[model samples]
Target chain A: MNSFQLLNGLTFAALLFVVASGFTLVFGLLRIVNLSHGALYLLGGYIGYSTATMTGSFGLGMLAAMLGVAAVGLVLDQGLLRFVRGQELRQVLLSLGVALVLNDVALVIWGGDSFTVPTPELLFGAVPVLDTFYPKYRLFVLGMGVLVFVLLWLLLNHTRLGALIRAGVDDPEMVEASGVNIRRVFVLTFLLGCALAGLGGVMGGAFLALYPSADAEILVFSLAVVVIGGRGSLVGAAIGAVMVGLLNTMGQVWFPELAYFVIFGPMAALLAFRPLGLLGRAV
Target chain B: MLQVEDIQAYYGEAHIVQGASLTVNAGEVVALLGRNGMGKTTLIRAIMGMAPPQLRSGRVRWQGQDLVGLKPHEIAARRIAIVPQGRRLFPSLTVVEHLTMVKSARATEGWTVERVFGLFPRLAERKGHRGNQLSGGERQMLAIGRALMLDPELILMDEPSEGLAPAMVQRVEEIVLDLKRTGLAILMVEQNLYSALTTADRIYVLETGRMVMETTGAAANADEAPLRRHLGI
Candidate 1:
């Protein structure tokens, strides 16, 4: 309700958009419920933290996070998921195995104590927004969200790769039969999606801090956002993120006891009217 | 050139394509004709490496390279494209997007998006429309256009005239012949005898997953009785 709360909501939404888009796109194209996504997010933040600590550059850390997670995604897709093909159940279980393994690996590498990724010196301070001051890092996240939106728009609408992604989402075999190496497309999309999660994780870590339980929390938030947004739509993910982000922050502010109730209440109503979610096409 | 020699495929325990074999030379238009449930589509799927009936034994050779074990995209990369039965189009993609999404097998002198639009002006007019939004005829045209985008040397069209109006059937016939004129080889599966008679250089009949008959276009055209005996139409 208040400006401060509204700003917090928007900032939260921006990060959510970055994370949930990857989740939905991977699911849409491959029908793989990549449980490893949250682990990847956590991995990104931890790697980003270590990379920045070593390099003394937030940019390099971000880059390393994205590339590192992308590498992991490619390995998962090419080495294991490709062999499974069309068994959604097998894929889900495989991904769960990956998630648990990665979670353990992360725990071994980084301790259970929480750590916050430092905002770049350029975005270290606060900026005035309406009456109260807002963190510059939040504004930076908002800017990154806008950039991601535009980039995704151009990629999906104007690029051949985008067309392939959309087509693959509809019928992957048909795309392959069109003489396209849809295998490469699938792998690349998976990597790109994971990279997005990495970016979001680093950004989110700046605000939310990196801790043992953060991955589970983000995974839950991302799942809720994708379910509300509907799968197979970039615009839907963005809108869903904003709705969930606002509801989460507002619920805590107004009705602390029933925050879960506040979030699910609207989601349930929306699903009752449109079972396919906001923008999801039928499977 | 393509050759399917002694290929046997199965759907679990149910034998589908039993010793099916056929060949297509360059600039040839071959029609695969059979009654419904004769495994005409299963043969096509086998050739394309899509397994419903897994290829248990076969040598699918294209230009001396065995394609039995190659993936769908690899087969496609060898300049083979399938306009699959029911048009299997991506319902979400726009007409223009369909033509742009493919990776052309031919680097140069290939079918471009503009060329496809010129071939089917109706598709050009509705370039912005999604695949599901287009009419039956338009959907068929878009499917063909999508295949053309790959610039394949050989195109496999499965029941291209299926579910089409009489007028649309005529259009598809003309389009098939027009594509043939470009010196591209075509293997078309058609129930429409007229379209087959019109476009095919040779016709092969499949009876329950086996190649039952093969006849030249000229001989088949001259004597309808022999072809009619196979088709029963």
Candidate 2:
């Protein structure tokens, strides 16, 4: 592929990584599929658009979106999800219901029109990349992805909370028996994951305009990323995101008619070969 | 101190721990001995507020606090810890991470990572190893060390010698004796009568979920016939 296609792939993968990282972590820790993740993304985008418009600050818009979605996630978990915590099928159905409700909410609030978050003046221009110039905002998104990956890596590797999350993933009962409030851990992780979803929404909004059904579309891509990467694995998500993102870009460029098949056909083959995913362990 | 009175636990429809009562005083080592499938592990799980032998009726009073309705973490915060059956180590986490993950309940100085290392030097050697990578003996040491890191006043250990070699079981006995010297109360469940006889100050024999016999470990060690008869071994 050409440099432009490559950059498109990398930047797109970066967005997928941000969205799917939280997706994987939540699944790893909570065992909740969180079908509303796409809804969260769309909601975050619209919230960002409004906030940025009202306050006239891109940064503030991003902040509002994250916090708002986090609050919503908290309510969803404590109010609804907790009732069916260990019932996997029920949680999935509940989240699907929530997602549908959220999609309607977005349509009611933001309507069916597509709108991009107005690019900040600072990031409006393009800069030199490997072989050509690229949009500075996309590059900024790339930087954000790298920063998030690094921060999450450090958090998981060097911090106590990270250890608890990893341990909880393995054996939550033992972690609790060791005297750590695993519920609090769950809440914190949920918030972090949701906030990232919000962040991804805003970032994706600015990169590609927000509209109806966007939630489902993003959700599908993220699901593909997680399934291919391995449920609940950070490095796996990163690799899967890149693979999906590049394939997506290549498909759109070369054979727009077969883009959907291009993205999912390989996933089907991979799943048939490795049902646990590339890096997933048996839960 | 821990007091368990009339704790009736069940697994679905199966009544596992039927009206079991026992106690472990502060600075004491108490072992519950039973044959396989006799509800020893279930009783421990009930005390820790774990599910799948849901506590139907029970009172596990630890440090004067009734443990009913408390989540497992809350019980842990009440200065209690558990070395669960099969080690139950986080397969992906390193040994040091396991020790460090515990948020000690007590404000005062207690078990630190360094002290745990000092107590189990082999754990120190395997500090960087993940839970799955450790040998059986090392996993047991790490499990015990992980419990101690909680700075708990009491520990509930389930099947500490279940899968260990005899040499490792001997090592576990030494560690239990060492822990007893630290004045930390322990409630241990074991099928290994010899290990229990060596380390426990007090022994309770469970027969089909009931406490059939209670005697000092010294007495039991002196006269294994009574304990063995109750255990049917």
Candidate 3:
């Protein structure tokens, strides 16, 4: 309806891209729908909040949250997920339990408090754009999202690890047969995805405010992002995030009562028709 | 050098590989001949530990070390690799990326990426092409080149000539012989009987997942009767 609303939509989309990319990457490589990703995201937010409060440095909080959650991802992958392997039902149940346990434990530690991470003083004010003022912190969120996109592109395309990831993504058995330690690849990819989700949590926590049920809330956004984007394509995630993010903001602006209804409509339609999303090969 | 003895593998309840045995000595090429659905592919899967046809009982030994129950990567690290059925090229990856994605696990000098390029100049010419962009012959060349990149002591080639043209099949046969000259052992499963007869040092026939006949390549090449009898070509 307005310029500010459109900017709000774009910023929201940027954050969604950062959050859902990890979920998509995990699905792409491991063929697992990690239900605990949302818990990990929430845990990162709390960790980022606590660490920033103690150190008075927001950057340190971001780093600690990423590393901390990545370690949990490794443990989850090695300790439990590895055992289940292709049993999709078992994987879902195990990850769901982990999510519930982590969220409950987080409630105990953080005590359901709602707070937002303080953007640095340099990014603490508003900037005028298109005859309107937008939060500088929101702009930073958009910038961080773009920065992540560029970094992921370089990592997936320009590096040796990226080649292995892509090759494994295409034909994992062949990669293993070609003499790669595929387990190492799996672990590394899991860690990368975890770190990304954690980074997204830090940003999301700052923007949306850290609070209880934030995990569940973001989980809904993430699942919708990936499903509408197609299961695991990075470009698909980016487009889907933008699509969902804009759709959410627009729905809230024009149709308040039917916001969520509109938000998930595209995903349902895609599943009924083109289940692979855009840019995805057939199942 | 490799020895696969009495390997009984299964795909769930279906007994796909029922007690098959074969061997490939050092610097030798052993052609495994069988009709379609005779468990030739499953035997290769069992050897590589892909495990759809789970190796229920088998003794696959290489240089006196047991290969049974080893993971695919472990088997590969011990200097064995597979070309795989259908080429199995990573469609999104470029030809050069396909070869460079894998490195030799053993601390030995075998085949390097450049060496592979020298062996298959066609691949070198199309090194920048994506796997899916390559022609069937090119896919086979890239697949073999990828297997060579692991610097394997023994390579398992499954249907490298399955869909190739006659000229390409001849090229593949020459490549196998060339690999043997460089002291790399090969176990090639081929439907093209002529390619196998020309390239292999020894030949073994499998029927219904069982090894039924064994003979030298020279003998098989000299006489079409055994080839005609076993394969009914």
Worst 10 residues of 1 chain B by lDDT: B100-109
TM-score of chain A of each: 0.97, 0.98, 0.97
Q: Give the per-residue lDDT of model 3 (tens digit) for A1-283.
A: 7889988998999988988899888888888888888899989888888888889888998998999999999889888898999788898899899999988999999898898876678888899989899999899888988998899989888777888988888988888887888889888988988888888888888889988888888889988998888776888899999999999998999999999988888678877887677767753
Q: Model 1 off-target regions past 4 Å?
A: B103-108
Tens-place lDDT per residue, model 2, B162-232, is: 88999999999999888888888899999888899889999998889899999998999889999989888
Q: In candidate 3 chain A, what residue range of length 10 has the lowest lDDT sum? A: A274-283
Query: Which residue segments of model 3 deviate by more than 4 Å?
Result: B104-109
Report clash pairs, candidate 1. Answer: none
Between candidates 1 and 2, the lDDT winner:
2
> What TM-score do all the candidates reach, one by one?
0.94, 0.97, 0.97
**lDDT at B172, model 3:** 82
lDDT score, candidate 3: 0.86
Q: Report the lDDT tens digits of candidate 1 across residue range B33-140.
A: 999988888889888988676888989999999998888989988888999999987877788778777743233467887788889999989989988898999999
List the lowest-lDDT window of 10 residues for candidate 2 chain A: A170-179
Interface RMSD of 1: 1.5
Question: TM-score of model 1 relative to the true fold?
Answer: 0.94
Off by over 4 Å in 2: B104-108
For each candidate, the DockQ is 0.71, 0.77, 0.75
In model 1 chain A, which range of ten residues has the least summed lDDT?
Answer: A111-120
Q: Give model 2's docking category.
A: medium
